[model samples]
Each structure stands twice: as structure tokens, then as C-alpha cells.
Target: MHTTTEESVRGCPDCGSEIRVHSRFSAWCAACDWNVDPAPPEERPGRLARAQRAQARRHGEKLLTELTAGGTLRPRRDASSVLAYALALAVHAVTLAVAGAGIGFLIRGWGGFGMVPGTLLLALAWSLRPRLTRLPTDVPVLRRADAPELFTLVDQVAVVVGTRGVDAIAVDSSINASVATYGIGGRRLLTLGLPLWEILTPQQRIALLGHELGHYSNGDTRHGQVVATAYRSLVTWEYFFHPYSDVTLLTMTVNVFYALPRWILLGLLLLLDRLTLRGAQRSEYLADRMAARAGSTEAAAELFDWLLVSESAEVTLMREANGSALRGRGGSGRDDERIDGLWERLAADLRSVPEHERERQRRASIRRGHSVDSTHPPTWLRQTALRIGPPVPPAVVSETGRELRIGAELAGVRKTVARRILHDGYGN
Candidate 1:
């Protein structure tokens, strides 16, 4: 087995996998596929800058090791994190309250020229409000009868994780798994990306689902959105705070007074944002731990590792398939299963590559290492966290069981989801 290494050594900063040295000055990460190349010798960081960064990494590594020492992953309520969130909420609430009051005063003709300032402030507040940028998914929701076996597995995992059943479940063409809570209380939507599902065995699928549910169990989804809304509200004033404005010169001059304070407020909000994001990353670790405990630790790690391969292969398939369609090469017939066939071929192609070649591809997938702003921790950190306790025996449901229960029933649901994805993307 390949051994894991410390981040202090030659490891990819993004996912912490051992880096393959490409030359004297360049390297790549095998786990997340992040590329790293040193600047020209004259342009490299100074000794002090390098030392400071090294010390900072060591400090971060030390903190994670301590927090996760026992390996029974649990959500931590850090004082700094709580304070940051509280402050974010307070900031946004104050902004809305002030702007609303000002607008109300203007409505009543409480001030003449003052209404201009009120208009500007209220506009700024409205602009900064968190936008619902993520459009609703058009994929078909899977019902129990639609995929009885798969729904059974979801129910089983939900019980194990001590949560109520999902209100709705969906399948998508992307290689990701996510859950969101929306509408009135208790309404939740759990999305299972088919690309990720296809590459994962049934056990890993269970772990993956458990992880998504854990986000709910930990209340990360709703609380995260709450905190994010605060930052977005603050960001909205950016357009108004700039040098130009359509308002009267008097109002413009008054608004000029907000320039420095605007940047200062933004700075503080950004600092809080960093702390809040760190808390979010911790939340991911907690979810990963829950998935390991409720499902299978081994499978959880494998799910992330396999994503390195499957995600890239998925893109390749989509690109080629879309290209083929452009050439007027329509799919054979209703029985052809074009998307599924294309994915299978792509997956097979990836599997057939030499180990060395696979490693290179894996490294290419990386964007960068862990950052304070990322909601998820590095993949290696997650793997290490999940492996903390005594080994748990993995579940051993046979292929026959899986096939009779869920596998045979998924085709119809899968086709509907794929059709929706195609319609939404290509209008075909």
C-alpha cells in the first residue's frame, strides 16, 4: 500500500497527496490533481515569506490533528466561529433595519434632501442581499415506486444517521452529491449525482448519502446560508460605494464620506468571512466522520479517491457525446441508452490506462490545496480523520441483494433524470 505523507514534505497543497516531481522546479498532486511550479529563481518567495508560510501550515496541521485526535468526528462550536456568525447576522440585520427605517421616514416626507441619502442607503442594502443564484434543478424527483430499492437504501442510511426520511431525492448528470433545505420547515431536497453514483459501489453510495445527510444533522446547510446572506448583504453596497453615482452632487458628496468606512467595514466582514468559512470546513469533517460511523469508513475514503478518476472521465464523455450530436450522429434508438453507453466507455477507457498515466491524470484534477475559504477540507485530511477509530467491519450485502433490491429498478429513474438534464442544458 502507498503510505501517506505529512504536508511538510513534498505533497500537493490542495489535497495533500504525495507530489510527483515534474522537474527541478515543478510538481503535481496525485490526489486532487493540483499543479505546482515554482516561479523563476529570481521571482521565488523571499526566505522570510517562505518561512512564514511554512510555519503557518505547521500551525494549521497541528490544529487539525488536535481537534480530530479521538477520530470520532463531531461538530465543534468554537467561540470565534460563533462570534463571527453572530456578528455577520448582526451586521446584516442592522443594515436592513437602518435602511428600512430611513426609507419609512422618507415615505412620510420626514426629510427633503435627506431622502436622497436614504434612497442611496436602501439601494445599497438591497443590492447586497444574498441572491438566489442557484436556479432550481429540473431533474425528475425519484419516488419510492420509481426506484424502490434505491429509496430503501436511502431510508436505511437515514435511520442509521438518526435523521428523518428525505422529502425528495433527485439524480443528476454531474459528478457530485449534495443536499439542500428549502421552502417551509422540514422540506429538504437531496440530490444524488448519477456520475458519482455510477462509479461508487453500493456501500460507497451509502457512505456518500450519509455524508450529505450529516450536513443536515449538523444543521450546516441552513446555518451556512444564514451566515452567507450576511456577507452578501455587505457586498451589495460595492456598486454604490464606488466613485461614480447617478445621485445628486450633494448626495454624492455625502456618499463620499462612506468610502473609507465602506472599505473598513468590508475588511472586517471579510475577516469574519474567513473565520466562518473555517467553521464550514470543520462542518465537512464532522459530516465525513458521521458517514464513516454510519456507513463505512473505507468506502467513504474510496468515494473521494474514485472521484478523482470519475469526474474527469465524465467531462470527457460529455464533451465527446455533445460533439458527436453536433455532427448529426443521432443516437441509435430508444434502446441505445446513449449517455449511459458513453459514460461506460469513458470509465472503461480510464480504467484501462496504465497506473502511471492515471497518476498523472489525477494530479491534473487539482485546483489548489486547502484554503480558509473552502467549505470542504482537503481530501487527505478527510481520509485521515475517518480512519481514527478501531477498524469497523464493512457491510457485505451481496450483488444479488443489490440487484434484486435497487439496481434493476433504477433504469427508468435514470433515464428520466438524464432526459431532464439534456432538456435543461440543450433544449433538445
Candidate 2:
């Protein structure tokens, strides 16, 4: 039996506060509530365990803070945002200068016409606002439950990653979700699309949300927007000053004048395209890793598959609108040169596995898969990733029948509106 004496009631040795010993081996401090125990014979927590516990505590605290809304965790993006804006603006200016200088030699009126188009392009580029300072607005929906569940997932992921809840979630029939952060000051908004709500399970959705949150947290969103804005400006400049339509018209008409210079400018446009596509592919890969880290790898893969399918649908829709000419825009053709080696390399990496071994792995993955990757890699490449593992965790599948039912109702509402508006408007 463990004995107790007046010594047992002595103050805690650790804090010099009054303590009561319940057992001979352990004492509890009344003031600090510190639990004191006899020194271990020889065993103690090692460094790794101590570090892990500390990490766990920190992670837990982070989650709690997001949930309760009393944490000091705001996205710290000052230097990166400034750098992104500066670099983007500088690049845009340089491109305009080069194009302007080139066109200046062609015009007779002191080269003022050269500057006109270039200045217009610069203005267009400057119009796309930075994503960090916009206020958020929630998308309205008849299905109230889906919104709350969506909030739950957002909250959970925000907690894990240590960020604020998403700024807004929007509903659209289009099967796509983009992670965007915009605005100038403290009013930055993060927006999500409703297509994600239809496609992703709660867990997978959280994983996806976590990826977006990662972009916001890492200041990647601001950087991406800057790049996109700059690229858009470049496109605007190209279209206004050196339009393909104008070049074609000039080739047919008496104005064979613009055709030769337009052909030369075409090379520059192609080069810019190649660079932009490469940058987009790399940025996508980084976002995928962020999702994987925050949630299951399976969810990332599923999300990728979903994205590929979604893109295919979008391509089909575009083709319907424009005709067969628009078909297979991203497949082999002029566009293939834009993606350059990315698709070919990804396809090789994914398709090189032996057939039988691949089939076995595919079967296993069907039973328990990794989530989707964010980037919509080549279709064949995505199929390979799917065969290797599930796109989402088994836990992500844990959804109540209620959520499924609600999702169905939301789908019905979407269809009803689309039938009345889109189907009628398009005369389909």
C-alpha cells in the first residue's frame, strides 16, 4: 500500500504552492493545479516524442482557434504580395515597351500610333484587380444543409492548416472549382464553386478546400493572380495591336502591309504562350502537394480525375458552341506545342508500368483510393494515377444519407433553372 503522511500534504516542490498527495507516488498542487509524480526509475520522454507532442499540441491549438474564432492567425503576406505585384507590373511594362518600340519604327506620325495600342493593352492589364483586397459574398441556395456542411468542412480544414474560414462559396452548374484570393487591403476574399459541392465527399471536399487554403496561406493566390493578370495584359496587348483577324484581313485585302510584321510578332506570342502554360502546370503541381499534405492523397487524385472529366465536358460544350474547329483544343495540334513537354512527360511517367502489375494495383486502389491531385494532367496520365490508388480516403466516404439527399435536391434546382434559361436561351 502507498503510505500518506503530513509530508504528503506539503506544497508542490515544483511551484512552491500548497499541494495534496492522493497517492504516495504523485502529488497535485492546489494553486497551479500541477500534477507531480515520482521521478521515473530511468524512463523519460525522448526528444522526438517531446517534439511530436509539442507539434500535436500546436496543431490542436490551431484547430481550436479556427473553430472558436479567437486566434491571431491571419495570412502573413506582405513582402510576397508586394514582390508579385512589382514583378508583374515590371514585366507588363517591359513587354509594352518592346512592342511599342517595334511598332514605333513602322508608323510615320512620330510613332505615336505604336504607343496607342501598347498603352491600351497596359491599361487592360492594369484593370484586373489584385485578389487580396476583395470582400466575400456567399452564394445563395435553396438547400440550406449543404451550405452548413460545406461550412463544417471549411472550418475543419481551416483549423488543420491554421487559417481563417473561406471568404465565400458560390454555386454554379459548371463542374469546376477554382481557388482565388483577391483584393488590396484587409478585405481579401477566397471563393469556391458549387460544382465541388456536387462532386466531392465531405472529406475530399475538405482536402480540396485545404488546398485552396494552402494557396491563400502561402501567398500563392496573390502571386498566381499577379501572373495571370500580367499574362492577360500581354494577350490584350497582342490582340489589340497585332490581332490575327487583322492579319488575315490584311493578307486578303490591299493592306498586305500589316501581314509581314504580324507574322513576325506571332513568334513572340507563341513564346509567351509556351512560358505561360509551363508556369501554370508547375503552379498546379504545387497546389496539389498542399492538398495532399492537409488531407488524404486519395482525395487529391479524385479531385484531379474530376477535374479532367470536368475539362472534357467543358471542351465538349465549347465545341458545340464554336463547331468542330474548337474540338480537342488541348489535345495534339497547335495547342500541343503550348503544353510542350508537360503532357508527353506525364504520360510516359504514368503509362510505362507493366500491364498486369498495373491492373493488380488498379483493383486494390478501387477498394481504397487516394484523393485527386489538383492539376488536370493529361487524361491518360490521370487514368494511371487513378489505377495506382483511390482518389480519396475511406473516411471521406463517411456521409449521412441526408447530405446525399440534399445534394440531389440542389442538383434538381440547378437543372430546372438551366432548362428554363440555358436550354431556352440556346434554343437547344
Candidate 3:
């Protein structure tokens, strides 16, 4: 939270007090009843759950087609994905046209029935509009020259996965490896998490790369991007369309009539959203399977478990290290040479969990099923999916040995990544 202390734009005009900026979208005066945020948040004029929603949705069936069913590993078109794409497109079209037509009509016939549909349509369109943009703050981009060993490893994984090559590679502070594609032309980008790279064996690293690249190869990336954007719009629409209005005689009547169509729009949008999530879930499973095939299912599965452990261990270590620095016990260069293997530390921390607790978590992982909003299948399900079919022979991407030859450089890279993560935290 940022608090203003001067008579600036952010300070309170009436009271001359500092305004408390609770968040980017809201602020308030502490001395009076001046709420910078609306009671109903007029930002209908505005604005974001996922525990593992990304993981749940990231896997699709195409990448792991051979492993999931009896066939050679290859990408297959998903009917649901097509439907999701179509629906997302249809949603944007209808919302925009409705907004234009409705607003034009309402403006011509203000304070009448036209106002009802017009306001609603405009709101819907506003809701459907994309409200979020990813801003890169801390994650650093890596050129081929910056990390030739890493880029070479990626090339090997790409060959093994048989995917179109990515245009750029970024080293992020996250513990998960991910890929992003932009524009209709599908300019591709890959993000490799320093945390994941810090501990994963060469085979596991290949698996990660293969899974991310598989999204591009399967053509799911393009469609998935549409659905993902549409899903966020759904959230925005809901906010704008919340059932609140002025309670006057005329407005009460308008509100009464507005109820039916609003609910109808809500129902329609929600149903379409289900299809989007379902397709994404399939994609996640497929991506997971692809990674497994590229490396080994065992390594892929272990990676997931390690991810769960890593998230916790990483936070703990960062906190402890920060606290230590605050107390003048250590910082920056103090442990620069000593903090590379976050995954190894994470593994050691996992061992501290009681055996029974570990057993319980394993059971829980298996019991977890497909999540409607998650991108990846449950860890247990991913493991099970790989085992049911004859596993693809692991691609002998012996590049790991070659990659490891640059271990000193890699270690320095890891230390830099860790420091940035700890110092800056993951920027939004």
C-alpha cells in the first residue's frame, strides 16, 4: 500500500490528509468518509483463483496422444478445442455488436426501454473487453549467446519433441517452465524457471522443454490463447454486471426488467466457459504426457512432486535468507557462491515431512481428479496416464552431458536467478 503525505494528486483535497492507496485500482481518505473506490466499484468501468489452474489447463490430449491412446505419439485435433475457439470468437463478436447497436439505440432513446438493453449491451461489451496486460518487471530475457549451453539444450529438446522452434527464451523466477505465443502469426516465446533448472536432472529438463514446445507443435497454443483470453473476459463481465443499481422508481423498474436478460447472459457465458476449461484440461494432460515421452514419465512425475515441494521450500528459504540479511547475518554476495541448488535444498526439506503425511499427500494427489479451472490434470492422474500405455522410448538427448559440461556457468546463472527472485519477488 502506498500512502501519500503531501498535497499531491493522490492526497485528500478536503482534509489535506494522506490518501491510502490500498491497491493499484483503489485508494481512500482515512480522515473522512471519502471512499476512492465506489460502493459498487464503478470500475464496471474496471477489473482477476487458481491454485493450480495453470497446471490444470496447460495439458491437452494432443501432445500425449500416443501415450494416452494406442497410436504413434502425434498431435490430434480436438473437437472441444475447435468449439472453444469458435465460442470465444462468437462471444467477442456478439458482445461488441450488441454494445455498438445497444449504445446507439439508448443514446437516441434515453430514459426509456432502449436504455435497458443498451446499457446492458454496453456493459457486456465492456465486460468482454480484455482488461489485463502482462507486464515484465523482473524476469530477464536470455539470448542464445547469454546461455548457449541452455539454448543448445532447448534445441535438443525441440528436436526430440519435433516442435516448431521458439523465437526467444526467458529465464523467469518461477518454479515452473512455460511457453507463450503471441499475435495471429504465433511468434513463440519460452520461459524456463531458474528454480526448476537448478535441480532437475538433464532428462527432466528435456521433459520440461518438450512439454512446453509441444503446445506449439500441436497447434493447441493458438486456440488455447483465445480461450484463455476469453475466460479472463468472463471474469471482467461478471464484475461489470453485478446486480446493483440505483433504487429509484424509474431505476427500480429498469432493474426489474434487467434481471431476466442479465441472468440469461450469465447462464450462456458460464456454459461456454465450461467448454473452454474442459479443452484446456485435456491440453494440460497431453502436454504432461508429451514431456513424459520426451524424457521419462518417471522424471516428469517426479518433477511435479518436486514442484509442489519446491514452491514451499523456495518461499521458506527466501524468507529465511531475507530475515538473515535484515539482521545483518548475510546478504547479496555473502551466499552468492552457495545458493545454487534450490531443488536439492527443497528435496532435503521434503524429507523432513513425516512419512505418514507424505503418504497422505500421495493418496490425496491420486484422489484429485480433473479440475474445471485448472490447466493440468491431477498429479496422480498424470502419473497414471503415462503408465497405462506402453511408454515411448526415451529420446536419447545426450545433450544433458554436454550441457553439464558448462556447469560452472550454469551455477552462476542459477545464483543470479535466485538473487533476483529473492530480492524482487515475482512481479505481477
What's the C-alpha lDDT at position 397 in model 3? 56
lDDT of 1 at 304: 63
Comparison by lDDT, 1 against 3, better one: 1
lDDT of 2 by residue, 274-326 (tens): 33332333334445545665566777665655553343333433333343234
TM-score per candidate: 0.70, 0.46, 0.66
Count steric clashes of candidate 3: 19
Q: For residues 122-227, write the lDDT of model 1, one tens digit per residue.
A: 7766666655434256666766667766766777777777676676777767778888765535367788877667666667777888888878776452256666
Each prediction's Cα lDDT score? 0.60, 0.45, 0.59
Candidate 3 to truth, TM: 0.66
lDDT of 3 by residue, 189-251 (tens): 788877667667777777787788777666563345666677676556555556656678877
Ranking by lDDT: 1, 3, 2
Model 3: residue 189 alpha-carbon error in angstroms: 1.5
